[model samples]
Target: MDQTTSWGILAALAALIGGFLWEGGHWEGLIEKTALLIVFGGTFAAVAVSYPASRLRQIPESLKTVFRPAAPDVPARIDELVELATIARREGVLALENKIADHPDAFIRNGLQIVVDGTDPELSRQILEFEIDAVEQRMENQSKIFESAGGYAPTMGIIGTVMGLIHVLSNLADPGSLGPAIAVAFTATLYGVASANILYLPVASKIRIRAADSVQFMEMMLEGILAIQAGENPALVRKKLTAFMHTEEMSFARKKEESEDGTETEQTQTKRA
Candidate 1:
């Protein structure tokens, strides 16, 4: 789970609510149900109108992805690929067919399968690149939904405030009630702006960040697949995969590989408020 992300969101809420309370504001003032309905319900209605059901269906999964992104085990992946390289060198490329079947990850499995089928390297790269692009485009679309919601929410809030103001004005004879009514009206604005900044836009950003990480991981897998197809040395394949890793990841992969054989093998493997 993304503790930092969860904690950041909590912090944002705590600070906002804490500051409000510090200023002597009561919880009742901020708990205007009508304002919430306008900001949240209207925002959802607008987003529903903007996107198709198929796309909207992705919201649950998108939120899941944002909060619990599947971080690739880079070092373990490098070790796996290097092990594949060793097998191919020892047993020939065709020997990988059975091993590839048991692999659950369709991305790398399909790419390696293509290579095993003797497809041209460039074509394999193109196909995998196209897959990456498709995945990226889908991710882009998903994030845009939240982004669009963020854009719409503030407007919905303003509209709610206007509606509330209109209601307040219609009761002009109740001079004593004007202040509280006006306060109630303005709560819509607060809900709108706050949800936009702290929820919608931030969720959209987290989704994009996680998507980029996933795409890069797939790219790394593609490189390893190609190296294996080319019959590169196991250590060299590990090295190529390691190119995608950070300094710390490089050390982890190296240590893990060495621990396996007592010999060094080189390989390497978001926030919302």
Candidate 2:
């Protein structure tokens, strides 16, 4: 589970509800079944009309990705790839075959299998790169679905609000109910705006981020595998793959080195003293 996404959603809901209560608004005033049905149902229908049946089926999985994002250990991946390169350099490329089954990532495993099988370097790179592009396209499609829903949600809410206003206007004979009716009519607008900004749009953004991360990781793996196939030095492979690490990862490495240097200096001073 992604704690940031989970906590962020919780924090947003808490702020919205807490602010509403602080403003002396009753929670019951926000509960309008007709408004909800109109906004949510209409939004879904609009999205359905916009996308194909096959793409619609991916909504569940895409939503799951929003809450439970993939957290790839990039540094660890680079380290593992370097180790694999070392093994391949020490033993022949065929030696990697024994470790292929033990490799956890299917992408890496497939690449290694291709290398072990003595596939043409150009062909292997082409195949892996194609797979990478395909995966990225699929993820982009899924994210776009949510993005389309977000775009539709606000308009659906407006439609619901208009419907409610029509009913309210028709019943304007009772002046006493006008205030409550107007309030109820606007609830659809609130639902639409809130759901779009807080849920749909954010989920689409998260999916995009996840997709980018995935593509970066795969690209790194492709480079590593290709390097191994080319019989590059393990140290050189490590240097090249390290470039894929995020800035934060690089910062952490720098901090770790500084701490180690300080520790060594302190030890030397104490011994000299």
The Cα RMSD of model 1 versus the native structure comes to 7.5
Q: Which candidate's TM-score is highest?
A: 1
Model 1 per-residue lDDT tens digits across residues 116-227: 8999999999999999999999999999999999999999999999999999999899799999999999999999999999999999999899888889888999999888
The runs of at least 3 residues in candidate 1 whose Cα sits more than 4 Å from the true structure, single-residue gaps closed, are 256-273
Model 2 over residues 163-273: C-alpha lDDT tens digits?
889999999789999999989999999999999988889989999998998999899999999999999988688778877878988676456446756998999999999
- List CA RMSD, all candidates: 7.5, 4.8
